[model samples]
Target: MRLLVIEDEAPMRTALVETLKAEGYRVLAAEDGISGLELACTEPFDLALLDVMMPGLDGFALCRELRKRGKTMPVLMLTAKGQVDDRVEGLDSGADDYLVKPFSLRELLARVRALLRRKEREHALGNELSIGDAVIDFGRNMLHRNHKDQPISSKEAGMLRLLASHPGETVSREKFLDVVWGYNAYPSTRTVDNFIAALRTKLEKDPSKPVHLITVRGVGYRLEP
Candidate 1:
């Protein structure tokens, strides 16, 4: 699973990153709300850990903006204010859950697991996805073609999941950068192109004339199946 932590405190953010990494999750982080909002909107994270107070675009505003943009990812708001009104406000603003400051790491992890489990259950009934001869087992993160398992890198698996989620819909270059790379720090679009090439090589019968993963010139890429 992938998670994004939007905390302004360096120590807290680092600790959260390390903890989540230890739990086998791919984590991306930002120091301020602006960057956090950007990452949340562009990335395909399973959940977001947003600190309520920050330099720009506080958590409430960020949550509202994400909802406005049609993002449905689970958002857990972290706040120093533990009062009833603050919790109500956070939920009213669109946070799926709220975590008060000085929380136990174990509690946080439990909440994270619960939220991700809910998301998985929701998406479990979606249509089966296929690219070329490969069938993607999302729940298992295993790809099978002709009853044979194929080895795929974590990055490649992430990319495939994103593309498969929106089959036949063009995913923008910026979206790929944020989600697949886990941050918006890449200096060029070449990275996306390279990954697309690699994906085609693995999932297409003819990489030169891909039928499933198609590129839209001057735009981005799309998957047909």
Candidate 2:
């Protein structure tokens, strides 16, 4: 998954980025709220992590502006202040979740998972995926393309859904394993390539020279449609 982290502290921001990257997320970060807001508004991130205290625009204002602009990406507020009113303020400002400083990494990871899963479920209401000439009936595990409809595995459907969520952006192989296949799953990184190859055959006009499912040199794969 892609995430935006807006934090002022150098050390804390670095730590958050490294930690989330290790967990297989593509992250964009900014040290000030204005820069953060700009990046958040421009990028295709699945979530945002905002530090509550910052110079100028602050987390609350950034989040409120994001909501005002109709960006429904989930926001998680981070702060050292752990009082009742502070929590209420975070929520009132449009943050979906809040995290206190000096938090256990385990718990923080859990909250991140929960929020993303909730977002995933909300998107689940849509049972079809349309990319280029291909249409996937995820509800029925079928892929229709080139005037033919063929059966596909649940894992393949999940992989396509995840990749489709972020179009025209490279999704890392690590993210593929972590989100679609789960972190602890036994598949190695090569599994992503194999899946992509199979998917190309199903969705692309030429599997040997794929167009829609293009590999991003050293990073991962990107969907053009």
State TM-scores per candidate.
0.56, 0.56
TM-score of 1: 0.56
Model 1: CA > 4 A from native: 125-225
Please report, as a residue range, the 10-residue window in candidate 2 with the lowest summed lDDT: 178-187
- Model 2 misses residue 115 by how many Å? 0.6
lDDT of 2 by residue, 22-82 (tens): 9999988999999998898788899999999999998989989998887878788889988
Write down the TM-score for model 2.
Answer: 0.56
Query: Given candidate 2, what's the lDDT at residue 212?
Result: 84
